[model samples]
Structures are given as C-alpha cells and as structure tokens.
Target: MTSSAPSTRIASKLGLSDRIFAGPRSRRLLSTVEAGLERVDAALVRELAMADSLANATSRYLYDAGGKRVRPMLALLTCQLGDGATDKVIDGATALEMTHLGSLYHDDVMDAADKRRGVPAAHEVWGNNIAILTGDLLFSRASQIMARHGEAAIRLQADTFERLVIGQMHETTGAQDDDDPVEFYLRVLADKTGSLISAAARTGLTFSNGPAELEGALTVFGEKVGVAFQLLDDVIDLSADPDETGKVPGTDLRAGVPTMPYLLLAQRSDTSATALRERIDDGVAQIADGADPELLDDALAELRDHESTQATLDLAHRWSAESIDALAPLPDGAVRDALTRFARAVVDRSR
Candidate 1:
C-alpha cells in the first residue's frame, strides 16, 4: 500500500496536538508517535500476509477497512518513555495490534454481528467457522511474534489472552446470582478491554528500556483507559448515526447483551425508568423472536436520551479520570503529558 505523509489528522487520532504535547519538545513527540504509527501500520500489513490467497484476504479485510489504531498507539506511546520506538518496541506494537484484530473476528462471531469497521463482519461474509479460524490464525501469529521476545513476553501474552477469554466468558454467561451486576460488568470490561491495553503498554516497556517504576503506573493507566473506552462504547452503541460509528444502534440490546445502561436502568424503580425498561424488554423479546432489530429503533432512541445513558457516560468519565490519576506515579515528562491527553481522548471520542 502507498503511504501518505503523516498529517495532523493522524496525530489527532491519538489526541495528540501541539497544545497537548507542548513546550520545546512537543513537536518532536508528536512526530515520533506519527512516525511510529506509520511504521506499525506497515508492519501490520506485512505480518498479516499468508501463503493462501483466502487466508491473506480474510486477514487483511478489517486492516484495510480501517481502525483507530488505539492499541498500537498505546504501545507506541508508552514505548517512547523508554527507547523511543526501538525495533522491539515496533514488534511489540505490531503483535499487540494483531492480537486486537484477531479478537474482533471472534467477537463478531460471538456477537453474530453483521458489520464491523463499516463493512460486513467476517462471519457474515465467510461463515462463523471460517471467521473463527481466521481469528485463531491471527492469535497464533501474534503468539509467534511474542515468542521472539522470549519467556517474559510469552508469559505476558498468555496472561493477557487469558483475561480476554475470561472476560468474554463472564459477559456471555452474565453476572452470577451473588455478583453485584454493575461491579461484575465493570470487571468484565477491565478483563475484556483493559487487559489487552494494559498488556500493550507493559509489552512496550518490556521491549524498551523504560524504568521499572513506570511499569505499575502504565499498567493501571492502560487498563482503566480500556474500561473507560468500552464503557463509552456502551453509550455509543445506543446513539450511533451508523454513518459515523459504522454500527447500527442497539446492536447490544438486540442481542440481549446487557450494557451499562441496561443494567442501571434495571435498577431504577421510578415511573419513567420502569416504563422505559418495559419498552426495552419488549424490544429485546421481539428481536429474540426473529424480529428485525431496526424495528426497535424508536425504543433505542428513547433509551439513548434517558438519564441512564448519562449515568453510563458519567461512569465512563470516572474511569477515564482514574486512569489519569494513575499517571501521577510517572515522572513529569512529555510521555506522561501525552498519555493524559490520550486518556482524555478515549472519553472525548463520544463527542
């Protein structure tokens, strides 16, 4: 693929701007992240290739469609605190991104999602078995990449993958009878979303020469940011334009997937909330009985405008704020400053 010059738009994707990464070195830091992302993008394309034409096409499908590069950006940004995108750092970022891409295939299969990244989901195009295999193929390749970094990296990848699986399992199974649904769901977000992000930052630090003291802080920061990002996604799921978010609104509700808003709404006993809950439940049932999800568009719009949506956004903001607080342990520097901007960017994406 031909490359374009790194522009302000690319930097903006990571929430980087002169105002945020400022002082004499601000431009330098922004340039570094842009350059690193370019390299990571190129590396991802090369690594995703295969001997079979079908495997190659399936692998590159979503990559070509486009993503925000959030995981790789986190990896690249954190690695800057150390050796500034060394070869190992680039490799780590590439592997981490592959892990994320691979997971999406499986997620789409599980969600039975029809579209992703603005196009047909792999499962919709290739069938669930093929889509699942494609996802596993991506994960296997990612594992091979991590193996090159030796035992510590391998173990880290394993632990991260474990969290991803466990998180999905919890989400699929729902909260236990004894579990606090809200708390349980937040933990699921941490495991499913936050764990991989946390690993990306940690892997970057491991591959580079970042200080040991920075590890704990970056880990907390990455995971919390992950949870916040997902929570924001819950809100977004209810309010998308389809043109902008590349997703139909209320896909979660249609799937009977209980998002933050659904859980919170279930807890409220007020008249409006109860009335809204009844409408949502009926919508969910209709979808379950094979009704088209679009039929429930009116109800989703109502839920989106309800106070529960605001409550979900507030919860996301809280997680984002906590992620920023985790950065306090890091030394005052451009990296920390940029990470603060990045965390805010995750929450601000909803706007």
Candidate 2:
C-alpha cells in the first residue's frame, strides 16, 4: 500500500500494537507532545542564533523547516508517565533533540541531501564544512546541558551518545558483502535507532526511581520498537510516496544500502541474490533494465512474509506487554495508562 493509505487491515493481525493509538489517552499525549515540540523548536532557534548574525540566520532557516521531534517527545512523556515530574526532563529532551538535529545536519552533508523537512538542508544553505561545525557545536552544547545535572544523568547521556556514535560508525564501515546477515542489520538498527529510544525510556525510569525491573523491560521495549521503526523506514524508503516521505524514493537503492527487504529477498533468489551483491559492490543499474521494479516488489513481498518481520513484531509486542505489566504494579491513573499506550503507539506509527 502507498504510504498515506490508512494502513492495511493485514497489519492488525500481524500484531502491530494499537493500544497507544486509541481513545483520549492518545489525544492527550499527542497534545502534550505538540506543546513539547514547540518548546524544542524555540530552543533550537535560540541556540542556532548563538552563532554570529549570518550563522544565526542560517540556523533559523534550518529551524523553520520543522520535523517530527519524536525523540524529545519520547523522552519527556516517558519521564512524566513514570511519575518523574522534574523540569530536568525538559532539559534532557532539549539536549536529545539538539543532538538529533546535529546528527541530521551531518547526515544531510554525507548523503548530499539538498532538502529536509521541506526546506534546504544545513549543508545546502551553508557550506558542508560550516554545517559540520554547526553540528559539532550542537553536540557539544547538548553535553554541556547534560553536564549541568548530577553525575548519574551525565553518565547516562554520555553512554547514549557513545552508542549513537558507534551506530553511525558501524553503518559507515560495515560492508554490505554477501557474508553480511540480517542479524548484522539488526545490530546496526539497535544502535542507530534504539539507543536514543532506550535512553528516553531509561531516563524516565531513572528520574522516577521506578522499579529496577522496569528499566530492563522498558529498554527492551524501546529497542524492539526502534527495530520495527527502522525496518518500516527501510520498507518505506523503497515504496513510500515522495510527498509523504519528504525525500525521493529508492534512496537506499541508490545508496547501495542493502536494507532488510532486499537482504531477505536475496536469501531466496539466486539471480536476485547475485544482483543484490552486485548492486552493493557496484550500483543498482547493474540489474538489467525493467528488473528494478520487479526486484523491489519481490523484495518488499519477501519482507512482508519473512520470519524476520514477525520476529520484529514479536519483539515489539513483548516489550509492549512488559511495559504494561511493569506498570500494573504502579498506581492506576491516566498518566500510567497514557504511558502504556505511548509504548504501544511507538511500534504502530506508520511514518
């Protein structure tokens, strides 16, 4: 189905959790997230302006384009749901968002992306070097913010940052050779996508001093949801409409990133498999003309049918179940329910 299509009925049976997408809980959490995102945008604007006037203007230009700000919101809501009512979470959220933006700025330069969030990328507005410097500055500022807190918070943020860097390095270094397996993809995803999520949830538990059991459970939940999220991203990268995805289709294809769909398909087809390895080593054009579309479709179908996707779903579901059960021993309230649903929603989101 196209990206904007109201998800296929089949996804429901696949155990894609929807508990977080229903009722007043979802609405309230969404409203809270919106408010939190606005605050984050304002902070980004203020900090980007910390540069000289020209740099400030360029930063503002990047800020105006807008984004989902999902990481920060996840950090904030998880903290609140865990009964941690400190403004420190907001500070943490801002730091996380800044770090995320910094990564995107650098990623845009590396990817040679011209636009993001419907506007020119940082590298497009400023030169690549300037964008890289700005990203560095943002990352440094994030650590500074985290450092204002006690050692525990500082250590947590530091660990999360390490994971983020490791994930990026792994992605850049890993060869998409024939020897690479789907498990490698999962590891890459866990670090790249899961680290921030794990940090967000763990921050909540830490702030609240929630049960120790909840920490591992929520971490698992975040990691599983993160994997599913990235898997869907890889899927959408191949199939999503340009308008919805805010980028060109076939990005992974062009980049020679052997995403899950293609990897799964390669496992089953000799010619397709050989073409995949060739595409990784050379380029997608190596595939015979008219083969690209068929191969992409077959890969997508294989992804849909593969045990890997189900395994991803199972992991996500297990975490959701654990997150809910972990909360069962806590006080019954809207916040707890909202938190539970939020975890459920993490895996259910289409975009």
Top candidate (TM-score): 1
TM-score between candidate 1 and the true structure: 0.95
Clashes of 2: 0
lDDT of 1 by residue, 14-123 (tens): 44464446666545677777788888887887788898989988988888877878777777778877877888888888888898999999998888777887899998
Error of 2 at 242 (Å): 0.9
Every candidate's lDDT:
0.83, 0.62
Clashing pairs in 1: none
Model 1, stretches more than 4 Å misplaced? Answer: 1-9, 12-24
TM-score versus the correct structure, for each prediction: 0.95, 0.75
Model 2: which ten-residue window has the lowest total lDDT?
1-10
Score residue 45 of candidate 2 by CA lDDT: 54
Candidate 1 local Cα displacement, residue 263, angstroms: 1.1
Residue by residue across 1-351, what tens digits does model 2's lDDT show? 111212212123223224543466555555565455555555555555564766555544544555566666566556655555356776777777777777887777766555676666788778899888888877887888788888988887788878878877877776456636677777888887878877776765666555666567667766766666676666555544565456655555554556666556556556645654454434344442424433454444444455544554555555456556655554565556666766566556553
Clash number for candidate 1: 0
